[model samples]
Target: MALAGMLLVAMTAWFVPWALAHTDWGNWWLAIPFVGCNVFVACTALLLAFNNSKRSIPLRVEVARGHEPLVGVIVPTASEPVDMVMATVGSVIDQRWPEDRLRVVVSDDGYSDELQARVATLAAELPHGVVSYFRPPKRGSAERIGESKAGNLNAAIRLLSDANCEFVETRDADDLVADPEFLRLTVSHMMLDDRIGFVQTIKESKTSEGDPFNNNELLFYRGMMLSRNADHCAFPCGSGLVWRRAALREIGHFPVWNLVEDIHSGVLALRLGWRGLYVPIVGAFAQHAPEDVANYFKQRGTWAIDSIRLFAFDRFRHMPWRMRLHFIEQTAFYLLSLPIMVLLIIPMAGLAFGQFPIDAAPMDYAVHFTGFAVAMELTMLAFAADRPLGAFVRTRVFLIGMAPLYAASTIRAFWYGAKKKPIYIVTRKTDEHRVYVSMLKAHWFLIAMIVFVLVMSARRDDFLLDFDPGSIYWAIVGLTGLGAFVRLSWFGVDVKRNILSRLQLRSKPDSHVQSDT
Candidate 1:
């Protein structure tokens, strides 16, 4: 019913406008995807207004008094820093749950000697059998399928099968469980509710005042998908999630077929008659946002690719109606990148060439589009969680910058759909201080095209000499998107401090070998 309502809104908004405004039948293919995306965004902007997810919800089910079940904690690491991993394990140990009831399995996928040694020493320093280091048996040096996170997790959980753990909680190597009583709350919520396969704790990144990266996900997790709370469909958001052991067994373990095991598991769990509860309360568990832009891209790219693949696989149609509504919006969210390029290019081509794509005058098109877009953006601002203006700008700039990555990822997903498998590289928790010019290759090509268009259009009398109102309007639109792209990918070309001595082929005049001689 919700899906029908959304489709109705989109068709009414788009088809009516197109019927009155469309110039050419050939252009429908060019324009529908772009306009359809705009309609979807407008719908989201409106839907956010009804967001009453801020109110706390009481759990419907709770464990019987004194029925504390043993929880097997799995900490999966992939060459992560030993100190950070240790800190995460230490935080788990500090939980108020009985020390004997909690078993920590450090799934060491990285196979680093230092990490193995450190965990052993740390284990000895603590209670006997409280924490154990698990080094997965590597079938080959060349990392193959099942050697990734999903495989390590499957192995780790299997080791706990003998221990008869009723509950299993996954904690990333970089995340720290913030509250000592967090497990009690999460486990209780799943006690009587056999349908609920997992309880996902909301990520708390800005535990400190100085969160420069602003990894806090209040809007995305709490507000954006608040509607899903009613559906009991809050999917996993990386680490800090607890799963029912029986549910995992039913689903045949974590989704090993895809790169995005987190969301995949949630979707599969739901399909297998299992539901998930997402705790919206703030500060449930601590996991910082991406500290670097490159790492952020890697994280988003992996997510986007798998989302496209899943949607393309006809799995969306098979999902239950309650779970189906959100995936439409979710898949479209990632797919929006392609249509955005189409949206920008249509107007950009108009600016470059005097002939507009549609039959309507440029002014009419611009005015109508401006009114609709402004209304949508304003609605988004009204519901925005923080600094509305800054958030708006950040979002647009990010969308503009990520267009290339999204486009490439979409192509990459299709490229590997049937043939070679794509390797899932773990996102680095640490920041990437070094900048690579190669990363901006797509942006460079885009900028070059924009400059060429403007230069060529300047020489044409009809292009801008007569000042066509439509041309001028579209030029502004194109330039605004381009400006956002520039703002994001602008790595200044100043390498004076970074220049190697060998690149200059010169040595310091004061340099001497007196001591060696």
Candidate 2:
């Protein structure tokens, strides 16, 4: 599959330049972003191919050295629901590790009195010293610390010093342990391989039935992580990760200031010659997947921006050449969104303006492109999903719709830089049965573009004839954009009921309503 993808990329590289050179369009500059977009797509195919070879390896359990090592399970929360926080605490308590060797710490940055009381009550009901709570110092206090999830976690480390645990497991406030043996399994790997700095477990979504975005995430964990693991570059995700205290200390603690701290930590560990492992088992369940379009954009955008910022870090400069290239490849994947959007829209713009760039017939281009696309899609489906091709196609539409949001995020990352204060957006459990006006507003430009193209196609008689290939391509692009718009604008029946109620009240006068009552 990898070889086939490489062949396709080689073909694209040759065909794109040849086709562009044959065009009579004077504006050669328009092809620059298109070329860039194609290059990124080819790189993605290569990466996907390389990832397919890395299957998960099983770990052998090791004999204990006299006594069980102490493990500190850190749960970081910032204004999350108390019930959710407590549920996570309960899950940690249910782990298969010895009770005496386990310590659960709730790192609450919100510092709320109600939260403190709840934790206190919950702790009292549990085993003595098994559960504890820590809060960052007050903002103006002498011991005040920097704010963010990283900061909250640093504070937890400090609070756990007395316990002096050999290993630390980081869990997000909303994440629950799916397997009671999660600790035993991950710890066994660490014990077997002393050089293993951290072990990352698979993060499965709480729900992914009807959500393509969520399905993509599941694919990422199942397929991509396997590939990364094969390369010995598997990094810690935001949650369900266990780390060795010695390795973290060697790396000078978590890069608290870095936005994508988990990745940063993983890279630093790798650079320092410490190995990281990927446990393919579903260790924990978390709300990492977005429930709606708005949340999806927000989560992906933040990740893109933060991941891009890693290039500026000084530690990244000292990594091995191969490691550096891998990091660059990862960042490039996130930053390709804008270029892709430009590539898609430019051809349509040429049609609207009577400046069709490509001289070839639409069918000719489609013939070659469709074969390569189908091959790539088949490779992906083989590795990522067990479902039919149609399901994968549907998920891909959502992925393509995300280009604009990713482009916006890449631009923001460059404009703001890494030094800017990081603002964490909490992912909430939202009702997908409602239409969020904000989500629609975010994609207004795409919606407007789709409407404008349709209007032009309908109003002008020569529009299709004058630009034969261009107009056809424009129709295809417009339909794709429309599909994205409709999928995102899924308004439930409640919206209609509310509108009807408003209309009924407006039609009735105040005096008439009172008389009727």
Candidate 3:
């Protein structure tokens, strides 16, 4: 399957330039972005193919002989449910590490009195000195307190520093260690290589299979992380990442101001010559993607914006060529929203104005385009061979649905610059699913685009003309737009349940009134 896919990709690559040469370049405005978009797509396809070929080999570590270093478990929380926080704390306490060597620190950025008391109560129940809580100092100015998870983590690090901790495992308040040996296993790898800055384990979602957001996350961890692992640039995801204290100290703690501090820190560590290992083993389980679609997009938007910021960093030039290329590839992956939007728009414009951008036969173009698309999807599926087909479909749906959000975030990041105050939206895990009216309203523009394309295409004499390249292009644009609209507006089972519960509540009053009468 892999070889066949490669051959298809090769064929497409050969055909792209030949087809583009025939394009009407008289319209440079349309010509440039279109050509640029094709080039980016081809390059990305090749890069993925290359990375997918590099298989992950298990690292040999002398676990029995390695020293058990003092590990600090930092759980960063802001406005999380108390029960979730307690569950995470309990999981940390349950770790198999020596009681004296393990330290659990809950970093509370929300500074809620109730949370503080809950942590205090939990700490008292545990062995003295086993658990600690740190809140950003109130006396300092807002800037001094720092903001976002990065700030909370830095404060926790300062508190843990007094404990003489050697290694730190960072987890979200809602993430729980499913494996008792997570710390032991991950720390063993760190002990084997003095230069290993961090080991990031895959985070599985606890949410059920029906949740598209969680299903998408599962696909990413299974597919993208494999590619990243092969390239030795596995991202240190915000949660389920373990770091050496000295390595972090060398880099001046986390990037307190960055929106995606974990990713920024991972890149910085790579630039500074620290090795990062992507542990394929699942160690912890985190709450599924935000139940609230708005929160989901906001979280993704933050990542998209931060990734673009990383791509623009000047220091990336100084890294080894391979590392530099890896950083660029990773950045390009997130910065794709603009390119995708442009690609979608050009075809629609071509169909509306009766100007076929690519002067190629319908059959020839369709063959090449379909071949490339199929091969790319095949390659991605191969990477995620272990995942179910349903998961893969759901994942694609989520990615397609997020196009607008990603494009907006990228543009906003560049326009606002680095000094813009970071926005931190807490992802709440709730069974009560509520749709944001504003989020649904945001998709109106996409729906309008789809409708406009349909209307304009219907007006053309060749609208239903079979074998016409212009008609084909119009169909593709319409389908892409419609798919995006449907995915964005689709509700999950939880939302359905919420709706049913509301109806039940309303009907209960009517039933009681009828019985009384």
Candidate 4:
């Protein structure tokens, strides 16, 4: 599969463009970046498909080795419900690490009185001095979508520093530690080598048999993560990992770069001469994915904005060449959707008018591009979805639905990441229950374009004119995008109904059910 991916990339990226350079539609100036981005995207997909997801420590290595480090688990929150806050704190207290050695710092960026009261009440019930809660100094929440998680975490690091904690583990208010031995395993990696900056673990999510949202990321944890481990390019997953204290100090603590910090901070740590490890422990942490389509787009948009800004700004000069290449491939992976802009337009341009994207034989283009796409898609479906065709298809449809926002993110990153923070919202469970037209606002324009093209082509008898393979190929692709757009909006519409109907059915208030009980 890897060889096939490479061959296909070579053919489409280099061979095809060169072979077609003399053809009427051969536009090298336009094709270079368009095809280049696709190649970069394909390379990343290949990495995810072929790379290893697991790293291991020697079994004989000692834990509780008299030098068991006192670690701080920092849980940051931004106006989340108190119940959600406690679930994470409770998990920290439940860690198998010595109760006295692990400290819980609840850094509430929201400054909610309700959370403060609940956390204080819970602290009284737990072991003496085992839990701590505090609000970091108020700063505007404009950066990194809505709230700056990095800002909250950086402040907590100071507390850890004052206490002389050996290491710190970051967990979002909803990201709960699952594996009791998580600390023991991750700490072992950092301890074995002082130069190791952090150790990341796979975050496992438990889902029902038919998860409409396709929330599970077991594929990423097991596949791409293992690949990063092999390339020596591991980065923190923000929640499910442990960080070395000294390494954080050397890199000047968690960096507030682009829109997110975890990946970029790991990069910064690497550039500062620190290494990271990716452990294949799937049960290290259990976290929630976006419950519905709207939040999923929101989550991915923030990521896309951050990842692309790196290309505009960050030049990784200090990191090793191979490590830098691996990082570049992964970070630029989100920009894959930029090609969708062309996908929507080129076919319509050929069919609706006479302007064709490529003058080459349709069969020639299809042979190369289709082969590349199939090889890439099959790997993701087979490996990423754990052999479930339905899971893979559903996830991909949603990704296709995100084409507009993803493209916007890439183009707008310069303004958003450079001059100002984009007016954006991070993923929230609250968003799962509500419906907003704005969630799919960008999608509307693209959907209308697809419809307009089809209508115009049908009227002009251009739909099947002149044995045009390029027009036909684009029609199929455009139709697929149209379907995805309609399908994603249906999810939003469905959630809207679900919310309104549930609101009408609500004669009572929401009750907090304690999972512990």
Candidate 5:
């Protein structure tokens, strides 16, 4: 809907030549903000385009042949399945790199005895050098929690401290490495240059089933996602990244205060002046929230709220000016999404009641420009969605749907930030198919917005065509945005089935439930 709304306004503006050609303050006042927002988007997109194309480190496999540094892989678990955890650990044991050069550490973050025993059994089966067990004592809150992931990580480093371990890696229990060369590729980047503080590999989804590359929605987000690693100032994702133990210690070991420790660690890395390299190779696969709508939003919202809360604490002052501006651009664009819905609705309401804001002459131009903008935006989105450049037009939802949802999410973020706290919510990683039903619930919101926008546009056609392009663009953007939501909801069902069948869950959804006495 957001993208559609933007397009509508642009088309409306294009029809009025005066709006496009006029520089006089009175004539093109609104055009300034409209064009300015677009210019920002274009510039950012262009910068990312260049960054994505640039080669950071030359790709080579021979770097890991002779002397591979000792790497400790840390898996932090709290109520995660033992079989899945062991499978992930087993994969580490099966690394192409020499077993002598690798150590696996599984930190039990206060789970039940059954879970602890499961991890212990796997730990006993591993080679002598590899040690996997419950977490030990550490400073501050971690000690209180009996070996929290962070504390457990610190403990792992201390245990391996004497072994001359060079790199420390962290990932969740459910993640699977698609390529056996995961350590070889990531550690190679760090080995090539001592200055490089960390190396992060690209992440793919295992449940994507079928040629994972064929999906349109995944294709679109990959650009926005991977571009982060290409830039000089890139944000970090918790999984699929490797850090230097020495560098981590140089900065205070992962601060526990913030709920989103990944972002907190990122801010620290930048401040300490350590270089982070993003590898283009897809070495690992991680699952999204398996079967719960609430789980999905909780994860997304936690990230949104944490970003806002961290910035709210005046952390930007320590960052460089360019980075500060970058953060603001990203945050503002996301935060403004929700409120923009209302801003879009007001003029839409006026059209419904026959009190349109702009004159007919300007409205025509707005309509024209909106069409051009939509075309350009879609082209960019499609290109970004599919890397190495292939058919993008067919995958327009991921591109267009972002506008309204980004706005809505941004508004929600700001409210949470204002409250001065974060809610720690973990995404569920289950194989149960029950989660897909929840997506159907969220889809209703998209349906309502689509209906509202379509009805208003059809009824108030004349006024909408007359007013500035902004309002019209937003109203219609909602309709197009629903396509992505629906696509995701549909994908959820597939994910549930794949996960349940793959894991061999015993209980079926249709089975009768009996109440306890």
Candidate 6:
């Protein structure tokens, strides 16, 4: 529905320029916003390119050995299924570090009695003194308070810190650690440098099947995560991140106010003059959004809200000169790109009323649009330096397709987040394939608009640019962009199609699965 509406708006936009051209509004108003957005995108791409060129830190030795700092892995989960939760716990227990030395703290943010029992079972099965479960005092629903991932995490930190755990690690219930040596590798670095208080590792995807629409979300995330190394100051990601307990204590602990604690904590760490390290080692893998588009938006909304807060609140200014610039550049890149996306829909909306604006002053629109296109190309080239040509090509299109959607959601999140009424909704995850069968009414309309553009471009032969090399290049680029929308549904259709039907999958007994708050 949302997509269909956007298409209609886009089609309507074709006529906006023509209509406006007839009037005396002049091209300056339209050109100004469009040009401003273009420059923002171009500047961001360049900064990211600069960040990706720096040095990567290596793991230190014997950091997890006896008598060393006791590293605790804190996992907070809500409503995740039994199997996946267990897989996460097992992964932590199975790490190469000494079990006796490393402690796994599972915080059951879920208020469900059944899930609590599962946590009990996992704790019992583990070796003596290796794993412990902490249940926050149930107030209202877990989701409303401690059940929320960030709140639950703060609860665990208070518990472990009291227990004298020197350092804390945070991971989501669904996340998998690909490298068993994850703790040893990362802890070694932190131990060696007291100044380096927080460390986050790059995330990778191992699963081939996912809900078709958002399967590749993780790939884009990974690409962005790897690109952070270029900035010297790394951003904090929820999973595969470790923080020093003392540092947390100094900052008054994780702020429970924000949906994304990792980001909040990262900015706080920098303010305190503590360095945050980005380790390129593949520490974790996890599932992407499988079935629900709403859930996908909600997840993205959380990040966007936090990002905006980070900048609007002047959180980055607390950092040193070099580190502060990176955060500012990164945040500006994100917010600026969003308005560009939202504005594109305006031109579309205009075309629906027979306003055929693009026809009135083709040359002017062409010039403005041409500049935007070049800015996009520069953005792609900025990231293309480190990416495979194939992946880079696909990501560019994906970024383009997501612009409008991202813009809309960011606005919605900001509005709700400002009121502090945005609910923390959990995403449903099953090891089954789900198809995105319904193109929103809006999406269908957008498709029609695209078709209309093609037809009009063809009928008005002059509208179709000459088939020169540059035209051919743009044609390929545009088609690849169209592919991004189709790719959104690729994972779930491919992997989880028959997963549930093939097996009589049983929900593990509460006593058998661990539930972390």
Q: Sorted on lDDT, highest at the top, how do the candidates line up? A: 3, 2, 4, 1, 6, 5
TM-score of each: 0.82, 0.87, 0.87, 0.82, 0.74, 0.76
Quick one: how many clashes does candidate 3 have?
0
Candidates 1 and 5 compared by lDDT, better number: 1
Listed per model in order, the count of residue pairs whose N, CA or C atoms clash below 3 Å is 0, 0, 0, 3, 41, 46
lDDT of 6: 0.60
lDDT of 2 by residue, 437-513 (tens): 56655356655775686577567877544545434444465467546645655533366788899899988777634
| lDDT head-to-head 2 vs 3, winner | 3
Q: Which regions of candidate 4 are displaced past 4 Å?
A: 13-15, 25-67, 140-147, 205-209, 283-288, 361-387, 417-419, 423-426, 432-438, 441-448, 451-465, 492-517
Candidate 5 at 1: error in angstroms?
24
C-alpha lDDT values of all predictions: 0.67, 0.69, 0.71, 0.68, 0.57, 0.60
- The lowest-lDDT stretch of 10 consecutive residues in candidate 1 is 47-56
Better of 1 and 6 by lDDT: 1
Error of 5 at 192 (Å): 2.0
**Model 2 pairs in collision:** none
Error (Å) of candidate 5 at residue 371 is 5.8
Question: In candidate 4, residue 345 scores what lDDT?
Answer: 64
How many clashes does the backbone of model 6 have?
Answer: 46
Indicate whether candidate 4 or candidate 5 has the larger lDDT. 4
Q: Per-residue lDDT for 1-517 in model 4, tens only?
A: 4555455455446544543462453544444544454555566665554443333333424357466788888888988878877888887788677787877899998899998888889888877766888888777634322247878888777777777888888887887778777788788877888888888877755444555555665445656666677667788766787888888888776776556788888888888878888877643444466656667667877878777776667866688876776666655556666766665565565556655545556556556556555666655565554436665666666556667778777888876656576664557755444444566765666666767877776777534444455445545665675566555444535666777888877855556655555
Model 1, 427: alpha-carbon shift in Å?
Answer: 1.8
List candidate 5 stretches off by more than 4 Å. 1-57, 136-156, 208-230, 287-292, 314-333, 339-347, 360-364, 375-379, 382-419, 431-473, 483-517
Better of 2 and 6 by TM-score: 2
Error of 4 at 218 (Å): 3.3
